[model samples]
Target: MKLRTFPQGVFLPHHKEDTAHLAIVRVPPPSRVVLPLSQHTGAPLKPLVQKGDTVKRGQKIADVDAFVAAPLHAPVSGKVAGIEDWAHPTLGRFQAIVIENDGSSEEFRYDPLPEDIESLEPESLRLFVREGGFVGLGGAAFPTHVKLSPPPDKPIDAFILNGAECEPYLTCDHRVMLERAEDMLLGLRIMVRACGAQRAYIGIEDNKKDCITHLTPLVRDLPFPTEVIPLKTKYPQGSEKHLILAILSREVPPGGLPLDVGVVVNNVQTAAALGRMAKEGIPLVERVITLSGDCLKKRGNFEVPLGMLLEDLVALCDGFTTPPRKVVMGGPMTGITQATLAVPVIKGTSGFLFFAQNVGKPEHSCIRCGRCVLHCPMRLLPYLLGRLAEEHLFEEAETNRVLDCVECGSCAYVCPAGIALVHLIKLAKFEVMRRRKRGGK
Candidate 1:
């Protein structure tokens, strides 16, 4: 059978053999955790507890009134040590609530939903998800409840479960699919009901044949029509837009979202987490992450507390086997490089990659190879956007639809000139968004 995929994507090494088959182990909480208030994309949360306040596992610690934000919950029983500035994986520094683990194993619980979750009202399910502090585990960290509640004018007909763990070396989703297939399916059903979708689909890359085979038979019993699609193993196949196109041949317009195309997409991990939340009466406190890289002594998938420090996680891996050059929080392609290990893993973190050798290369003038344009999944002119950005021509870049660039690093990976096309396009995108915010064209 011909596997489905979108056009203009590059296939790279999978780099997943090291830990792909490993089962997810639950790591104990560190001595302390740093919970950043701004982990989600929307408004930053305000601390609900001050210094010296004792909190239990699964306790809500910080939240805001914003509809687009997810609340923060304590992953372990602890005392609020302080609420102050700390190093963030993506943001340089942000106000974080530090908690010192007391190891009492005490927890706060919510009334778990009935076994037949579909019997519950959709609005009630959305409220439960919101209160549980669920977000997209697929890296965007957008609030999950918001996706469940689209505008009435835009009715959703299809929901896509993104099992395409296409990013190199990140196998947490793969492990989740294999180990927690039932929970993932349950979550998908809940999400489908909440979003009012008529049909559902699971898109897993062909590289993970085991996942497709494993999930195919299980989805047969779902209340709604659900199919497991084997996508062509391509980088960024897990991307929301691309996955939609691959599974349903739907195109999300420039600056538009899946809802515009009458669809919604979510990571398999996100669905599994929600399933667990409903079953276990727990919120989004801990998540599975891949802890593998060339420099680490140990490598495997782990269900780690949300705010566990990177340094502690490294220590659990028996420390590094070699001096590390670059540390990234998430898959290498779209992950953010970390300057220090002091930062804590947030809801959006998928994995930590440690490379022994520096991967930076000297930038050169674009030889006009046009490799970036050829491989750009969004079909944007990256070379033109990069040049326009370098010249500070934000208006022209925006006019050319530079904001559509997904920063998947396809252009950068294929660039012979090492021109940092993604970075330049990112800069242009930032400038364009800033100008629009300032009421400029």
Candidate 2:
């Protein structure tokens, strides 16, 4: 089969060879874990527990009054030291509940799973998801229940499973598909049932041929229509808009969501988590994260707790051989740089990349070579956006559709001038949003 190609995407070094074939290991529990209240996309969850209170594993410690949010749960049996402001890797400083492990390993009681899930109503299933503290594991961290509960006017016709692990050096989804094929299928079925969608499609990048081979036969029998479409191995192909376009040939309009086009996309890992929660009555405490980069002696995927620190993960991966200049939470392209090793891995963390020392010099000036424009997937002029943002013409940048930019870093990757186009676009988007919030008088 011929591979389909997309416009304005770059092919950079993957650097996944170090841990591509390594089996995933389980990291031991840390003595202390910091649970942030603002891990998801909506308002910060209100703390439900107070200092000196004891919490067991799977207990709900924080919750919100809003519908577009998920409650926070205790990952381990511990005592609440206090609520304090901690360094959040992505959101800067935020209030977090610090829990000191008491070494009890006590498990909290959960409601018994019904005899048959299919017999339950869709609303019941959605309630279960919300109570389980489920969120978009693919990185967005949007509440899963809210995503399932689309407005009545906008009906969902298709449920797309994002198996396209196109992010460089991130193989957590790849391993999930290969190992938990049945779980992925079951999760898709749950989603299909909940959304009342007609069909489901799993899109995998052509690079993961082994994953495709493993998932093909898993969905052969019973139930709904499920097919695996091999997408062209390109940067940002795993993005929601790009994946929808690549698989279904449907273009999500600028500044529009997949839901706008009658589609709801979920990550393969998120689907698997959903399946486990619905079937086995489990909450999301542990998730698979890829730990790799140049400075480590060992590199591989590990199923670590939600609040595990980067320092502990490094130790589990056999410690750093050389000092790492930069430590990112996700893939290098979109991941946030960690200020210190004490940063905990939140729900959206997929990969921990460690770059070697003395990598390269600082970025240089833009020479107007037009490489960024040539490689932008959104077809927006990144150079123009960057220039306008630099000149502080926020409205001009918005008129040029700067807010629609996905910030996938493709423009930065292809810039011969070493211009930081993604950063500039981000700044412009922030300003536009801020002005709109102030009523834009």
Candidate 3:
């Protein structure tokens, strides 16, 4: 069978074999955790506890009234050591609530879901999602409840479960699909009910043959109709717009979302988290993350606490085999590079990658060969956008739809001239968003 895929995506080395077969292990809880309120994309949550306050595992620690925000919970029983500015993996520095482990994983009961969820309304399902502190585990950490609740005007007819895990050197989703297929299906059904979607599909890349083989049979018994789609292994195949096009052949307009095309997409890990939250009463305190690269001797996937420090992971993995060159929070294609080891993992963290040797090549002038344009999944003119941004022509870049760039680094990765096309585009995107916020056209 011809596998489905979006057009014009670049092929990657995958780099997932080292940890692909490994089972998800639970990391020993760290001595300390720093729960940042800014884990989600919306407004940062307000701290509900102060210094010296006692907290229990699965206890709600912080939240906000913003509809777009997701609540945060404590990962382990502890005392609030401090609530102050601290280093963040993605946000640089943010106000974080630091907790010192009390040695007793003091328990709070999380009641299991009722015998059935069919009796629940969409709003009720979203409430459960928010109560569990769920977000997109695929990274970006967009509040799951918000995604589940779309505008009434734009009804979602299809739900796509993103099992693609297309980014290289990351296999947590693959492991989740293979190991927790039942839970993932349960979560998908819940999400489908919440979104009022009539049809569902799980899209996995062809590279993960094991996941497809494992999930196919389990997906048969879902409450709603669902099919597993084996996708062509392509860069950014897991992204929302791309997956929607691959599965449904639908196009979400520029600056629009998947919902605009009568669809909603959620990651496999996100679905599993929701399912676990419902069935086992497991709050979203811990997440399965991949820690693998050529730099480390111990490479595998593990269930890491939400706020565990990077230093703890390094120590648990027995540290690096050689001097670390670059550490990233996600996959190389779209992950953020970390400058410090003091930062804690947040809700959206899927992998922590370390490379022994610096992979960067020297930057060069654009040769106008247009490899970036040819391979770009979004089909934006990256060369012109890069040049316009480099020349400080923000208006021209915006006019050319530079804001549509997903910052996937595809342009830069395929550039023969080694031009930092994504960097320039990122700068332009930032300025464009800033100017728009200031009421500029």
Candidate 4:
């Protein structure tokens, strides 16, 4: 059977052998959790709970008035120890709310909504999603309520649930697909109703045929027509733009969102989380994450409370088999490397990768093999962007559309010269955005 795919993406070793088959284990919560204020994209939240205040699990502890932001919830019932600077997984250091577990296992439950959530008014559903702190769980962590609220001019026609699990060594979504298929479907239905989509689709990589088989029959339960699309196994296939292209034959214009094309896309885990929230009367306080790499003693997927530190997670795996040369949050393709494990798990974190040795190579001059350009899913001129960045010509890079680069690292992965094309392009993109923010052309 032919599998759907986007053009110009490179295939890589899946590297999911160690944890793909493992069931998600619930990790014990640490005595204290360090909740970062700016875990999601948009405005950073300010503490709602002051130091020494007692809070319950699933209680809203931090929030901001901005429409683009999601509130932070207490993952475990605890007393607010302090709010201070702490190591962040992406940011070097950020303000965090430290909570000391009170050992009561208390919870703050919202009034239960009807099980038939899709029957509610769309506006009501959006408000509930915002209150629940729902965000894209596949890694971007953009507020889900905002995504569901496209302008009237951009009416949403379809909803796509991403289950590609395209990044190497990340199988949290894959496991979620197999184990929580019903919950995912429930969430998908709610989203479709909220977005007033005519139909919904779930896209899974063909490499995981079991997931395709498992979900194909289940989608029949949804009110709107929903199909399980098997995407070709390729790196970055899970990218929102690429997934839309592969499944719907739609190309999102450069810097355009899925909504720009009358479609809304969300991760499978995000949908599942929403389903869980509706069913359990809980807020977003935990997530499933994959832990795997060469240096780890044990590896598998885990259901972890938010704000648990990476150091505590590593210890649960029985510590490293060997001292890690590098530790990365999320996947290797676009994940950030961490200098310390003091960082706590934030909403956007998908997994942690620990490598025994440096996976990087010394930079070399661009060999002009055209491989980076040939394989870039975005179809941008990465080599040209890299050179422009090296020359500190941010404006030139911007003119050439460097901001369109998704930083999937396909250029670096396929580069014969190891030119660090993604890094250079990222720098150029950052500079361009910084300049634009400062009102510079």
Which 10 successive residues of model 1 have the least lDDT summed?
358-367
Which candidate number has the best lDDT?
A: 1
Clashes (candidate 3)? 0
**Candidate 4 local lDDT, 295-316, one digit each (tens):** 9999999999999999999989
Residue pair clashes in candidate 4:
none
RMSD of each: 1.0, 1.7, 1.1, 1.0
**Residues 10-87, model 2: lDDT tens digits:** 886777667767777777788989888888888789999999999998888999899988888888899999999988
Better of 1 and 2 by lDDT: 1
What is candidate 2's CA lDDT for residue 177?
85
lDDT tens per residue, model 3, 339-431: 999989999999999987767777778788989989999999999999999899999999999989988888888898888889999999999
lDDT of 1 by residue, 259-355 (tens): 9999989999999999988888899999999998899999999999998999999999999999899999999899999999999999999999999
Instruction: At residue 19, give the lDDT of candidate 2.
Output: 70
**Would you list the C-alpha lDDT of every candidate in the order shown?**
0.93, 0.83, 0.90, 0.91
- What C-alpha lDDT does candidate 3 achieve relative to the native structure? 0.90
TM-score of decoy 3: 0.98
lDDT of model 4, residue 1: 61
Q: TM-score for all predictions?
A: 0.98, 0.96, 0.98, 0.98
